[model samples]
Each structure stands twice: as C-alpha cells, then as structure tokens.
Target: MVSDTLKAVMQKEGVVAIVAQGKAFPHVVNTWHSYVSVGNDSFIVPVGGMHGMEEALNHDNRVLVTVGSKEVEGLHGMGTGFLLSGHAKMISDGEEYALMKKNYPWARAIMNITILNAIQTV
Candidate 1:
C-alpha cells in the first residue's frame, strides 16, 4: 500500500522521474502524471509526454518514484518509494486513451504499469 503522503504528492503538478538500470548504468524518464495501482504491488501508470519517454521505458523497466509532502518535517515525511521491477508500454490505442481519460480526469494522458514490487521508506 502507498502512504497517504506519497499519494498526495503524486496528485500534485510537476513530473515524476523514474530511473531504470541500463547496460551501462541507468536511464531516466519523466511523467507528468501517474496512476498508482491499489494493494501492495508496485505499479504505476505514467501519463503525458509519451514521445521521448517511450524510449527510456524501452531501455529498462525497473523504476523508482519519489513523492512526499514538503510541508511535513524530516525525511520521514519526505522519502522515496521503490517500484523494484515492472514493464512499460505505450497506450497507443484510442480506446485505451479514452478510458484512461475518463477515469483520470486530472491526468492529461495515461500509461498503465504493472507493479512487480513495492517498498516503503521513512
């Protein structure tokens, strides 16, 4: 399960940058908005900016997401969460996009990510 604080951060503006391991080191991709799946699983559906981000997703699927409440004090309130491993795919179909658009009104666009692992930190 995701902490309330983390979820709140995700809902805000700006983008979440995910880092994945590559042949040499790591690659990064930024998403304007993300749809987090329920339960303990670590999955994220990153929405918006699909062009270049798709390339980064291809290199590596593993990702780490950072979200927090700046208002809160200490690292406990501002920490990072890990989505150890997962896959990323472009939501090219119009139907899929439409559904996501309907479901997530706040999101300009959407991507579906299946979580393989989820880790919480304080």
Candidate 2:
C-alpha cells in the first residue's frame, strides 16, 4: 500500500523522480509534472518533453518512481521520501488522460502507474 505520507508528499510537491532504463541507456527526469493518485496502487502523471523517455518507454513498461523529501521538499528542509515500483502504460486519450490534461494542459501524454511496491523511510 502507498502510505499517506507518500501521498501527502506527492500532493504537497506535485513532482516525482522517474527513472527509465534500457539495455544501453538510462534516463532520469523530474516531473513530467502533475502527479495524482487514483487509488492506493494507481497513479497518473502527466508527461511532456518526452524525448528523453522515448527509448525506455519503447523498450520497457516498468519504471521507478521516487517521491518526497529532497526531491519534493528540498527547499523547505522536509525529511525523507518514498520509492514506488510499478508498471507504466502510456495514454494519450482516455479518462485518465483527460484528467491529466485538466491538471497539466500542456502535457503530451499521461503515464498510468500501477504500483506494485512502496518503500519509505521513518
């Protein structure tokens, strides 16, 4: 289950650490911008400027997401963060995509993450 603290961090910061990797390359990008939880293990994050993600998204469907603390509240000096492992599916048109568009009107796509694990610090 995704803890309340993690969700709080996501809601409070609206950014996440996304890592996409393939056999020959690894890419990390912060905030395609606008992330929201649909359920305990499901989330939708808008993606823009996807040039860096194209290779990984094509070679793999799994992605790593880290949220909270330094990435979310670094400027505010908040402590800790969480890690989420999940499968991501790209969507350009759908209910989730519509919501993504509502939240980030300029986003080119939406990544629906079906979280399988949640790791956090005390």
Candidate 2, number of clashes:
0
RMSD to native, candidate 2: 3.8
User: TM-scores, in order shown?
Assistant: 0.54, 0.79
lDDT per residue as tens, model 1, 55-79: 6666765556544334433345553
For each candidate, the alpha-carbon lDDT, in order, equals 0.53, 0.72
Q: Model 2 Cα displacement at 8 (Å)? A: 1.8
Q: What TM value does model 2 have?
A: 0.79
List the candidate 2 regions with Cα displacement exceeding 4 Å: 32-34, 70-78
Give the runs in model 1 whose Cα sits over 4 Å from its true position: 3-5, 21-25, 33-50, 72-85, 101-109
Over the stretch 1-116, how does candidate 2's per-residue lDDT look in tens digits? 77666666666655677787866877777772235545788877677776667567778878888776554433336666777888877788978788768878988887788899
